[model samples]
Target: EADIYQTPRYLVIGTGKKITLECSQTMGHDKMYWYQQDPGMELHLIHYSYGVNSTEKGDLSSESTVSRIRTEHFPLTLESARPSHTSQYLCASTGLAQETQYFGPGTRLLVL
Candidate 1:
């Protein structure tokens, strides 16, 4: 089993509604990342954190925000949901000395 976890594996929301997707890992990796992907499309990095109290926006422009206050927790929040936001959100983590990233089961979102 993967060490990472994502809550609410699927979500359906109306436009303009707010939502939050939770991600956590038991592996105690200091680096965590969030990626957004469409079916059959390449994944885009949306947010990332290096450690507690350090967070950064990723290469992609995302309406979602993420916070990292603990070593094993990284939660993403979308202030306003939209149909355009419908896609899969994936969470990943890597140890400081590791190059391989372990991914969690992605959360699929559908905004109506």
Candidate 2:
């Protein structure tokens, strides 16, 4: 099983605030993904990266930036948060040759 974790599992912030949702994995996986979802909604891929120093935008139109500085770390940052940005952010990682993704406990953000 992939050992992944997210910090600040629950957060409440005001709009226009800057926030970063951190995601880390113990497994040395090269592929990481970030997803966003609303209450009772499907997940939307926001960002993903295959390896260090590689970042890719997913299907969703997001205002978040992600960095892949290390194989086990992929953090998502929102420069200016909004009410619409309030949702659950999920982190997932998979091995280079593996298709099965192991997910971390999501961070739930509530922007006031």
In order of appearance, the predictions have TM-scores of 0.98, 0.97
On lDDT, the leading prediction is: 1
Clashing pairs in 1: none
Whole-model lDDT, model 2: 0.94
Off by over 4 Å in 1: none
Candidate 1, 48-79: lDDT as tens digits = 99999999999999999989989999999999
lDDT of each: 0.96, 0.94
- Candidate 2 residue spans exceeding 4 A from truth: none
Residue-pair clashes, model 2:
0
Top TM-score: which candidate number?
1
Over all chains combined, what TM-score does candidate 2 have? 0.97
